[model samples]
Target chain A: MSVDKTTVAKIARLARINVPDERLEPLAAELNGILNWIAELDEVNTDNVEPLASVTGHALPMRDDVVTDGNRLDDVLSNVPEGASGFFVVPKVVE
Target chain B: MSDLLGLNAVAARDALDKKAISAVELATAYLGAAEATAGLNNYVALTADHALAMAAESDKRIASGEAGLLEGLPIGVKDLFCTKGVSSTACSNILKGFVPPYESTVTANLWAAGGVMLGKLNCDEFAMGSGNETSAYGPAINPWQGKDKVDLVPGGSSGGSASAVAARSALLATGTDTGGSIRQPAAFCGVVGLKPTYGRCSRWGIVAFASSLDQAGPFTRTVADNALMMTAMASHDAKDSTSTQTPLQDLIGAVGDGVKGMKIGVPKEYVMDGMDNEVVTLWEQGQAWLRDAGAELIDVSLPHTKYALPAYYIIAPAEASSNLARYDGVRYGMRVDAETLDGMYEATRAAGFGDEVQRRIMIGTYVLSAGYYDAYYLKAQKVRRLIKADFDAAFQTVDALLTPATPSAAFPVGRKIDDPVTNFLNDVFTVPANLAGLPGISVPGGVTSDGLPLGLQVLGRPFDEASLYRVAGVLEQAAGFTMTPARMAGGAA
Candidate 1:
């Protein structure tokens, strides 16, 4: 259950977070400590138990495929750090 | 004038109704009190102008005989709930300066009911920490102090709500419980916190952190105030697919209904080893009080209770990882610019999120990673089912289950900040109800030897918050726990 620095780095990258090299070691140790504590779950017998995904017990309520709310482009772009004419401005992803 | 801050929501509402005080006057008192106690760090943003505007509107409504249920009662909103046009960060750097264009359904409901907004109260960053220490603005100090005047942490991630309510800065405050966020802090601060059934309150605009477990409730000094707040906050919404369609029950009426002849279950599993001696003693006293009030106490066993914490840690983090992926630097909040989009995202998240939040995201990503999904995520989900089943079985025999709200009274601020596992364990007693989607409440039960507050928790069947209010009312009446924090009393002096 021990997590090494390499695994921590991998997880951090997967999560889209950057871990400075100096922090990676300490972060790995902390993660390992938590994961080790979580290992106690191995003792429980969960055979045939269905995974409980949603606690509400209701089917996800569906709405008709019609425009219900979101046509206000100004509201959508209001919080954008960088925006243009009805579009978010991100660093160019393609050349 | 300062005494107006001491009034509970029920009393305050009555005064506003009778014209004994104007909405503007009440709002001014609370706003002034909040400003006076700014050292507690209870609020992240004080919406004084908004409060005055809302109060003036409420005054007009009262004049026209159109007063709402909570007309003119000033309250604190947890920073996690989005306030339209007002800064609504989840007390994390990631959401710095993020003013949500849309309001959360719960807050919208409150405003519709004529509740005035005092401010956005501070919380643990993204509701991640048990102590408020993880908040980017710094921890909200518990109004209660320990020996030698050491400042204690108001248990969190709803620490600010609890502290403000306890300190009399706000008559009532909104709190969302994912794990023990509401109940734990309420217990620590000797206030009442109710975590309604999952989906009882819509999660439309509250910043998501473990969606299935997060539920918005209220913090107040009394069960009746909490009940009133709950009545206002709970509503079905089209936006939240998981929102329940059940009509809001008569929660306020249920408050005074004593627990007579009701079957209360004492879960044998909750009396764990190494628990605080005062907490154990207070729990026993609470059981005795319920018995005295004509409730039949039955001993029940929830064998899977011990696994709830570990299972919750896995499931919650996994959900958080997925939900937080929406916060990539492109659209909102702080963005660290770089040569590429991926680099920008990495830099922004690394700089924006705090240590605890980053840790959770890492754990979540690790658990849901391709090779480990079945072992960690799926296995935790199965344990979650077992936990729910245990509650279902217990509820079949008894109307509600009673347990200690938290392991101990408020501890020193820095006692367990560095230890994530220890801090995570603070939610051990409260997480099971969240995992099972049952309604739970924490009511002031007693005080520690040093005069700190402790609480007793009641967990009820799904959508059965009325029964919890009834049992909690009996406990509230019996405990008669009236010790206020030294800081709050002295401040009034």
Candidate 2:
């Protein structure tokens, strides 16, 4: 149940977070500590138990496809770090 | 009138309705109290102008004979809920300077009910930590100073709310409980906190932590006030998919309806090994009080109680990892630019998130990762079912279950900051209720020998918070626990 530097790196990548080389080992140790403790869940017998994804056992209410609320361009862009012409500016994906 | 800040929500509401006090007068008193207690770091932002404006409106309504349910009562809001045009950061650096243009459904409802906003209260960064130490603004100091003026933590991630309510800076404060965030802090700060059943309050506009388990609640000085705030805060909304269609019950009226002949369960498994003696005594006293109030006490078993924390840690982090993914630099909040989009995301997240938040995100990513999904996330979900089943079975015979709200009384700040696992264990008593989507309340039971407060929790059937109020009312009457922090009593000028 112990996590190593490689595993920590992979997790960081998957999470889209950056971990400097120096911090990876300590991070791995801390993750391993938590993961190891969590490993104790293996002791429980959950056979035939359906995974409870949500406590509200009913299906989510569906709504009409028509738009109910939106169209506030200024509000949408209020918190954007970089935006112009009602569009967010990000690193170019298609060079 | 200077003591107006000391009144509970119910009393303040009565005064406001009687014209004995104006909403503006109450709001001004609370604003002054909030400023005076700034040393506790309980409030991250104060909306004094907005509060006064709202109070002025409330005063006009009162003059016109149109006061709302909570008209003019000042309350503190946890930073997690978004207030329109107000800085709502969830106490995380990632959301620094982010002002939400929309208001959370809970806050909107509170405002509509005539509740005045004192300010945004501090909390654990993104509600990730139990001790409030992980807050970017710095931990909220519990107003209750232990021996030699040692500043204790106000138990979090609703730490600021608990501190403010306990300090009488705010008559009531909103809190969200994912895994005991509301109840534990209420216990620590010697206030009453109630986490209603999941979907009881709409979550729209609140920062997502662990979507399924996260629930908005209230912290107040009395069960009656808590119930009053709950009535104002809970409402069905179309915005939150999980919001229930169940009609809101008469929660305030349910209070003081003593729990006579009701079956109250004392779960055997809650008597954990090495539990604090004071917590144990308080729990026993709670049962005795219930029995004295004519409630039939029964011994019940929740076999999966021990598995709740592990499963909660896994599921919450997994969901949080997914929910928090939206915080990439391209959108709202802080941004650390880089040459590429991926680089930008990495740098921004690394810089924005605190260590505890990053750890949770990583844990979540690891558990929900492709290779580990079934082994970790799926298994934890199944464990969640068993935990819920445990409650389902117990509720078949009993109206509610009583247990200690936290393992021990409030400890000094930074005592458990270094150890994540040890800190996580503090939620051991509170997490089961969240996992089961049950309504739970923490009422001040009594104090330890050292004068720190302890709390007794009562978990009720889903959407059955009324029974909890009935039972808690009996306990509150019997215990008559009236201990307030020395700092709070003498600090405010």
Candidate 3:
């Protein structure tokens, strides 16, 4: 029910955030505090209780299978941190 | 000289309708007030030119006798709601300089109804924090100060919207409530805020946080103005599949309706162990006011209320992790280069997100992890159902529940900065409403002996926001809270 420094580091890595080594201990402690509090939910007997996957029970609206928006390459790429010729620039991936 | 910024949206609407003051003139006043109160750090961006342009358009419509419901009103948008062409960062660094290409469904509706944009207001980074301190742009300080004259924080996520409205900088402001974001700040700022039913407003174009819990609402100086704003804000957008198809009642007319013969519930469990005595007193006063207004009071129990916070912490973060994963230095926003793609994501997210956001993401990732999924995420969901059922059972007997909006009055800035758990307690009362996906409103209840504002919250049935408004209007009238903060725009005289 509690996390350690290694677990904190692992969680951070899994989350794709780079947490410094020294910060892991403190983060683990913080996470433990929250998790310890969250352990209270385990006391609730969820037997035969349905999980609430959605807040609203309305049926999902169906729409036509047509393009509502497109053809604006500039606008689509407008916010890219780096871009060239309408494609977002990223670090090299393949050799 | 005429103090145009001092007027509330309803008063301004009347003046504009009569042509006593032009839209351009009102927009100019708000633009100046927003600028004058920049020290509060309430706004991330002020759109002066856009305001004037839109105001002129509003004037033209008025000239043609075609003014809409909110014609000539200047409203502030929470940074979470995308305002096209204006820089819309949820007061976070990751999305720094990320100007949304399209308008959010809620704000677009506001604009279509003749509302002018005063600016983009500040909020917690990704709307993640309880106090505005987590905002990368810096916390929006509450305009209300205590006897000690020390600075106080505007409650988070929607702090900017609440503070600006209270300071008379914006007549109305849009706010998103995930975990008490709108209502908490509204309480701290002594303004009115409401989180409508989950699907009452469209989620499209809003920077996603907790998808299931996040609901966009309004911050206004009066309950009537809050009702008016909701009328413009709520709509069934085809773009947002979750947007409700149910037709909305007349929210504006609801403000005038009386709660006569209605049953108001005072949930006995909302009285927590360490809640401020003043807030407890305020709750009692709210009950008395409802009774005087012809509402028969019933004692109700939402036993699962105690478990709502822990469940909310688990579920909100889980959704936030999935939603925020899109910020991997890819499509838009801040990017940090690295030798490899994974390194780049690690660097970009680490550098881009603030402390609170990173913590939430990590917690969210942990809960959704392979070994922990059932124990945390799924268990939380089951608890969520119990929480909703508690409301359902209570609503069967009582029309709505009256509770304190926040646990305490606005505390000094950075008071609980190091203690995130303590900060989370601030939303304890308000979070239950979100978990249940019901409508809730925060009306100015009274003030602490030190003159800080407090808010009384009323929770109503699903899609029955009209009841909340009617209850809130009655509570507001009884509270007779007519004082503004001493540290408002242009400095309260």
lDDT (Cα atoms) of all candidates against the true structure: 0.92, 0.92, 0.91
Task: Give one digit per residue, the lDDT tens place, for model 2 in B203-223.
Answer: 999999999999999999999
Candidate with more favorable, higher lDDT: 2 or 3: 2
Candidate 3 lDDT, tens digit per residue, B1-493?
Answer: 3878777788888889888899999999888888888899999999999999999999999999999989999999999988889899888899999988889999999999999998999999999977788999988989999999888999988989999999989999999999899999999999999999999999999999999999999999998999888999999898888889889998889897878999999898997878899999989998999899999999999999999999999999999999999999988999999999999999999999998899999999999999999999999999999999999999999998999998899988877455577888999999988888988999999999899999999999999999999999999999999998986875667
Clashing pairs in 2: none
| TM-scores, all models, native as reference | 0.98, 0.99, 0.99
Better of 1 and 2 by DockQ: 1
Q: Candidate 2 DockQ category?
A: high
> After superposing candidate 2, which stretches have Cα over 4 Å from the reference?
B489-493
> How close is candidate 1 at the interface, in terms of C-alpha RMSD after superposing the true interface residues?
0.8
Least accurate 10 contiguous residues by lDDT in model 1 chain B? B484-493
Q: Residue-wise lDDT of candidate 1 within B1-493, one digit each (tens)?
A: 4467667789888888888888999898889889888989999999999999999999999889899988999989999999999999999998999999889999999999999999999999999989899999899999988667899999999999999999888888999999989999999999999999999999999999999899999999999999999999999998989999988789999999999899999999997766899999999999999999999999999999999999999999999999999999888999999999989999999999998999999999999999899999999999999999999999899999999999888888877456678888789899999999999999999898888999999999999999999999999999998888876822643
Candidates, ranked, DockQ:
1, 2, 3
Model 2 error, position B90 (Å): 0.6
Model 2 compared with the native: what TM-score? Answer: 0.99
DockQ category of candidate 1: high
Model 1 stretches astray by more than 4 angstroms:
B416-418, B489-493
Give one digit per residue, the lDDT tens place, for model 1 in A1-95: 67898988899899999899999999988998889888889999988889999988878988899976778899888889899989999998999
